[model samples]
Target: MAQITVVQITCGQCGHKFVLNTSTWPSTIQCPYCQEEMSQDMIPRVKEAWGTASDLNMDFARYHADRNETKFSVDLIAEQVHFPHE
Candidate 1:
């Protein structure tokens, strides 16, 4: 099993907040609720707002915290080209 860490993210355009697994953190992403694109540069401002636990932040916290699903998925496949038999 892989250790998963949850990170809170915010949409820079519409101020929507959501939680994502750290493994899936990217430079930019779209807000699930408003479909607004967000950049990594806005993380600091979002963090500050979240720290205060404002009304909107509270709403986000209640709805998006530790949700067991992810908005995106990645698949990796590896094949062995050759195998040696003794």
Candidate 2:
């Protein structure tokens, strides 16, 4: 099974941080806070965010798995695709 992760995006317009899904990559994305359309230039930002999310997820899973005596499921419970939060 594939591990699900979150991508944090800083809106160019509103400058607010929001969570994005990895599957929504390489597409037209908008900032929920300001409705700013993410241009091609923002691809790099998304990529960086995805990398950070991946690293965090991996670290969290590893930490739990190490401490748990039983099998640890790292599978994430997915929420809405585009959720804007602090």
Candidate 3:
């Protein structure tokens, strides 16, 4: 199984916090809450965490649709976490 990297990011426009699957990290993502489009580069990553394949409980292959460049996916969670801004 491929190792997955998990990251927490904050939406620059709406201050919405969410988690992301690095395997599916894309150039841009639509904000889940405000329905605003956000650039991956402009967002603030508040936390970095690790999880195993079993922890993810999802298939990474599904995200790789194009089979060319790497793919990224967004994993939103209900629990809230806070980290000092960098």
Candidate 4:
């Protein structure tokens, strides 16, 4: 099973918090709440947690269509685990 690290970040614009599961940490993120642009440096990370393969699979399914555009990839054999929301 692949383990994923989920980063909990807050949106600078709306103060909304969200989880991002990715192998590569992004320098910036789009707020899902207000759709505002925020920099990773500006928002504070609440925690780094672990996510299961099933969580990753769900995330993959949610964003699979934009995988190519986002240049994100998931490795089912990944061993380094990170974090998740709940």
Best by lDDT: 2
> What tens digits encode model 3's per-residue C-alpha lDDT throughout 1-86?
65444666567678977665566556666767887876565544322323443244334444454454355444655566787993
Better of 1 and 4 by TM-score: 4
Please list the residue runs of candidate 4 whose C-alpha ends up more than 4 Å from where it truly belongs after superposition.
Answer: 1-3, 24-28, 40-86
Give Cα-based local distance difference scores for all models: 0.51, 0.67, 0.54, 0.56
Q: Is candidate 1 or candidate 4 better by lDDT?
A: 4
lDDT (10s digit) by residue, model 4, range 1-86: 45344566566578777876466555666778998876566434422323454466557755755664342444333244668953
| Lowest-sum lDDT 10-residue window in model 2 | 69-78
The TM-score measured for candidate 3 stands at: 0.34
lDDT of 1 by residue, 29-60 (tens): 56788877765777666544434444444444
TM-score of each: 0.32, 0.45, 0.34, 0.34
Clash count for candidate 2 is 0
In candidate 2, what are the lDDT values of residues 1-86, reduced to their tens digit? 65666665666578787776676565777888888887788678768756766777777777767875443433333344755772
Per-residue error for 5 in candidate 3, Å, reads: 3.6
lDDT of predicted model 2: 0.67
Going through the candidates in the order shown, the clash numbers are: 0, 0, 4, 8
